[model samples]
Target chain A: MALLEVKGLSINFGGLHAVDDFSIKIEKGELYGLIGPNGAGKTTFFNLITGVYKPTSGTILLDGKDITGKNTIQINKAGIARTFQNIRLFKELSVLDNVKAGLHNRYKYSTAEGIFRLPRFFKTEKAMDEEALRLLKVFDLDDEASVKASNLPYGKQRKLEIARALATKPKLLLLDEPAAGMNPHETAELMETIRFVRDNFDMTILLIEHDMSLVSVVCEKLSVLNFGQLLCEGETSTVLSNPEVITAYLGE
Target chain B: MKTKSKLIKPYTKKSFITYALLIAVFTIVQLILNFGKMSFMMQSLLVPLCVYSILAVSLNLTVGILGELSLGQAGFMCIGAYSGALFSSLMKEAIPEAMVRFPIAILLGGLCAALFGVLIGIPVLRLRGDYLAIVTLAFGEIIKNICASLYLGKDAEGFHLSIKSAADMNMAPDGKMIINGALGLNGTPKDSNFTVAFIILLITVIIAYNFVYSRTGRAVMSIRDNRIAAESVGLNITKYKLITFGLTAFLAGVAGVIYSHNFSTLQASKFDYNMSILILVFVVLGGIGSIRGSVIAAVVLTLIPELLRETIGNYRMLFYAVILIAMMLVTSNSKLKGRITAYTNKLKGLIKKEKKGEIK
Candidate 1:
């Protein structure tokens, strides 16, 4: 069974169909790529899958379980997480704290325990801190753990966002414009990190990217989107070379 | 070297030491003021200082940490004061010991305020920034208006409510009116003391400090930083907002109980729009998210009039306006704020070094 199955997904903003009749089947452990030009509904499709926007009509299934129409947080708890096109870290918070926010759900303690300084609360908190620090180390941000997330450089901030997402332990990870502002060196590093994350965490990944070099490094399958419809989907080399996709989107 | 994350865990030694220092300082000041035969004005300022400090810390949870603007703190305070006052009044004959009665009254006050908190929070949670502030302001006005005209009387027949006067109400002659129109609650019990007020303030500080170090508190702060990102990470934004707001009201209500019991007479009109704004001022001036800052701001602001004495009477209004503007400027200006933070960090480092020497 496919890990994620979208059937006839559609999202309409007034008269405009921002994402229309989008469907795909992604198997577990596969690295999927989504690419398109500006205003071609690439982000709209992502918004739909992550439950940020309520699709005007569609059904989204994860491991054959229908996940359609759930709110963003609920969908996330059901094992889907995403990074933003623009990095969204808790700007004033410590890097470690930004990651710890994701690990909050892993423990079961009441507010009373928090207020009263219960032993269980302390135990869970210490463990959460360790895990959060470990995640920061993975992104090479451990040294900056105590620094405010906003104070980090642009590339580090992007890396912190991904680190924060991984703290949620999602079975499915979505990367939206992860390499938007990176130099080639950082882009190369991010590609390797993406592959490492999939292999190490054993999770499915779907990334939206304009950096074809980065995409080709990690993504095994590619789906071309243009004008709210799927232009084509196939193995990476074939889809990237499709003449129709080239003229409509990839050419420019 | 990575320092362990202090987010939402239990009390660490560092935080514990800070809290202990605060308590010690407050206790010493209270003792000196008590034993030094302080002037009546100074003595009078103590309770208000504690009460307002409690209010500031509670309001800070919503404004600074949760990043929501609330102008309805006075409404919650008024509810707490009345309900707490009602509890003491009704228990006057039954409970001879004021000590036994105060806790019950405070708890009842906290619960009543939380009830209103939930009621208002349900709708207010959907709003952000200016809209939320306006709606809360409206609610504060509504509570004030209701209290101004609300007349409740107790008789052999039961409780009766009338808008105009207690005389026209269908009740026995022995019946007494608890609230008079525009007069507010008549003759609430005077059972509060400086010691009790100090203890309550300390408790508020502890709970607030611990809350900021809790998992739920971390979630709430995350929402403040970035709602979409907080949500994307599976944090329940609404639940955390509601919880913080409700707890905020609970603490404000406790402050109300402390305030009302200190005086023989209570007026709902005292907790009007200005009261909420005053508390917000303390929160902002104290460095919004800092509990210690809130405590200091509340104390300093409460004592300003007394400290200025004779000149305060002539320039009281102007002085407050100018002071408030200056405080806002200091907080908002990046350079000024940076200097203050740097100075404080240097002082903190010195203190830590001295402490280490002591241990050695």
Candidate 2:
């Protein structure tokens, strides 16, 4: 069974159809890509799948379980995790705490236990810290574990966001413009990280990227979106050469 | 990888320093009270110093940690003071020991205020920023006005409550008037002292620090930073907000109990909008999201006006206003704040070096 299956997904912000009739199936451990022109509803589609926006008409099934119209938190608990286009980190928190916050639901201790310095609080906190550090080590952010999130360099901040998302232990991961503001060297690094995440964590990744170099190198299957509609879907090289996808990009 | 024993968590170390500071102050006060001469004026300022410090720290939890502006702190304190005083008055005979009864009263006060926190938070937490501030301001006024005209009395028959004058209660002549209209609760036992207040203040600091370091605290701070991102991460934003709001109110209520027991009469009029604003001033001057700063600022600011009253005579308030403006300028200006941080870091380095040399 596919990890994520969206069928007849549609949403309208007043009169404008922000995402219209978007449907796709992503199997477990597959690297899927969603590419689109500016304002072509790529992020909005991510928002829909992650339950940021309620679909006007649709069904989103995660491993054959219908998850349509659930809120963001429930969807995350249902095994879908995502990162934002503009990086969102807990700015006031340390790098370690940022990942630990994502590990919140996994580790169990009551608020009262936390406040009272109970034995369970110490045990769970120790476990959480170790797990958070492990995730940070995977992203090579362990050395700067105590640095505030806002103080990190741009490239590290992007990596930290991904690390935090991974800490949630989701089956399906969505990356929105992961290489948005990177130069060629950093984009190269991010491509390797994306593949490394998919391989090491056995993650099913669905990412939106405008960087074709990173896209073609990383994504096995690609879906092109234009004017809030799916323009084409196929193997990466085949869809890149399609006439409609070309016109959607180059404006023939 | 660094060994766990070698690495001290930054928050844990910082909180230990706060506890040490509190202990040092407590020692100095007790020493002066016993061995050295202390003016009557200075003696009276002791309990108030602890109370204001507690209020400031609790308010900081809302304004600093939770990043929500709350003007209803005084309202919560009012609820705590009245409820706690009422309990003490009713149970005066049943539990005659001041030691046992006062602690229960303090807890009761805190719980009463926390109950109000949840109820008010349900609707108020939905509103953000300036709207939340205004609504909370109104809430304080509403609580004060409600308590002002409230009358409670107990007789052989039972307890009677009336919002009108004391006469409207129509209690039997043998009954005792616990709360008189506009006069507030009278003859509340004076169980609060400087030592108990100091202990409570220390506990408040510990709770505030612990709450900031915990997983639940992390969720609350994340919501403060970015609500949508926090929601996307599967943190229940509402639950965390309510927990923080309730805890903040609970601490404020604990402060109210201290305030009520320090005097024979507990008046709702004392817990006014100005009182809430005064505590906010402490939080702002200390530095937002800074627990240690709140405690230090509360102590310094509370003592300044009173200390200046004898030294500067009628010009004391004018001097206090000047200090307030100066502190605001220093804390808010990025350049000044950076310079202050740099100087403090340098000072800390020197202290560490000196301690190492002494040990050697």
Instruction: Give TM-scores for every candidate, taking all chains together and pairing residue i with residue i.
Output: 0.94, 0.97
Candidate 1's TM-score: 0.94
Q: Summarize candidate 2's per-residue lDDT along A1-252 as a digit string, tens digits.
A: 899999988999999998899899899999999998999999999999898889999899999999999999999999999999999999988888889989989998888998899999989988988898889989989888888899999999999999999989999999999999998998998988999999999999999999999999999999998888888898999999999998999898
Judged by DockQ cut-offs, is candidate 1 incorrect, acceptable, medium or high?
A: medium
Predicted complex 1: DockQ: 0.68
Q: List the candidate 2 regions with Cα displacement exceeding 4 Å.
A: B1-8, B339-360
Q: Alpha carbon lDDT of residue B115, candidate 1?
A: 90
Overlapping backbone residue pairs in candidate 1 total: 2
TM-score of 2: 0.97
Query: Please, what are the lDDT tens digits per residue for candidate 2 over residues B146-200?
Result: 9998999989999889998888898999998999978889989999999999999
